[model samples]
Target: MARNSGRVGDLPPPPEPLAVPAVDAHCHLDLMDASVDEAIAAALAVGITRMVTVGIDLPTSRWQAEIAAAHPEVRAAVAIHPNEAAAGVDEATFEALTALARADGVVAVGETGLDYYRTPPEQHAAQQESFRRHIAIAKDTGRALMIHDREAHEDTLRILAEEGAPERVVFHAFSGDAEMAKVCADAGYVMSFAGNVTFKNAEALREAAAVAPQDLLLVETDAPYLTPVPWRGRPGGPYLVPLTLRLLAQTRGTAVDEFAAAIAANAERTFGPW
Candidate 1:
């Protein structure tokens, strides 16, 4: 992922901490400029007590597990991202990815699913095959299934149904509408909204947030990307999570502290205790 060209000025000033502890259920800590110890301190200072760093490929996924092993405050989710899968993820690739998914401190197999937005029609089959393989890996490991569903919701959902979704499933940076939210809610899939939910043009996403069951809601920065509003275009870090959490709380008409607590609990359930 590319960072803003604005240098240090591109990093947003940290928002006032939530005071109540919360977890950034999904993020790419390795993608950010900060070291793990530095990022953890910044997040701790802001009451973002725990973070789940996600990996988009094998090497990064292994790094995720290594960092998680070293830092009690961090956990990891590993998978070949949808776009990468579209490029052609062979069984050998999945074999290695599967081994990583079962590693210690690695709580989920994910950020894997269909992405029609960037991938062209010709590669759709490859993407779907990789998604199914990841689904199997998640189930096999008895870990949560982290999904990256973008403009391919119907197929994403269909694949899950056909593949028999693992007991736990999360739609990272969930991009669906209220109807899709309902489908996810009814199917017991967790929707982890990223900073993009704060955008003014995201009324439909806001609607989904408003109607989503509180228990099923989680929050993330997807940092180094989707940096939340007021800090839009700024390079994001875990420390900036308060901005998005506050926005999500307000959107749901919930108290900030209470909402934060719920998200923390949801994170624990989804990724296990941090």
Candidate 2:
């Protein structure tokens, strides 16, 4: 049978100016069900020139690295996520992830950290242990630590400080409350907001976006998941980044174009150049 071609559904109108350089800081492009080529084509059609594909486990981490290797516009972040970390990452898995981190195009070590929300108490200890191991790898390799903190703010912050994470730590899909936001901001960590910030009940998130230090702010779609408002019904991609960008810009009281430029530059600083 001839292969089906192109993405389904109407493509969102391309961003104006047609040359904006946008970086999607977090996405599970590998898990999108669609072909990576199709996703890339769709993203490019909407002005996303670069993306960071994140991994949640050993096999997926390796796949992320492979995706980065295949696509010049893509980079990888490898680690066992907090929910998956409960299985207790084996030594071999740690070594494999560390090796992938050292590989070219692997920019960070994570989507790793505490997620007490869904993790059962029986496996919480193992999750913390796994988090420490990933932190150590980040410290040793000097790769940025991409953290995923969900309903475990204090523990996450404590472990991050205790482990002495590197200067380039990033809190992917950061959902911390005001005080927690202050803690991360004080520590100079990057807080990446996603579509969650655009949700109707996300006033706190919007507030966090407002007070996040200018240089420390970043944006992501966390695509195929937290599709931002205005594009919530649409399939997620780097192309929809502008929707989130516009929301953030409005919340931060900055021009959309100016904020877009800053986010692009911030992404480059955090994940390195595309």
User: Who wins the TM-score comparison?
Assistant: 1
* Alpha-carbon lDDT, every model: 0.89, 0.82
Give all candidate RMSDs, comma-separated.
1.9, 3.2
Backbone clash count, each prediction separately: 0, 0
TM-score for each of the candidates = 0.96, 0.92
Write the residue-wise lDDT of candidate 1 on 53-150 in tens digits: 89899988888999899999999999999999887887788999888888889999978999999999999999999999999999999999999999
Q: Poorest 10 consecutive residues of model 2 by lDDT?
A: 1-10
The lDDT, on a scale of 0 to 1, for candidate 2 is: 0.82
Error of model 1, residue 85, in angstroms: 0.9
- On the 0 to 100 scale, the lDDT of residue 203 in model 1 is 91
Indicate which candidate wins on lDDT. 1
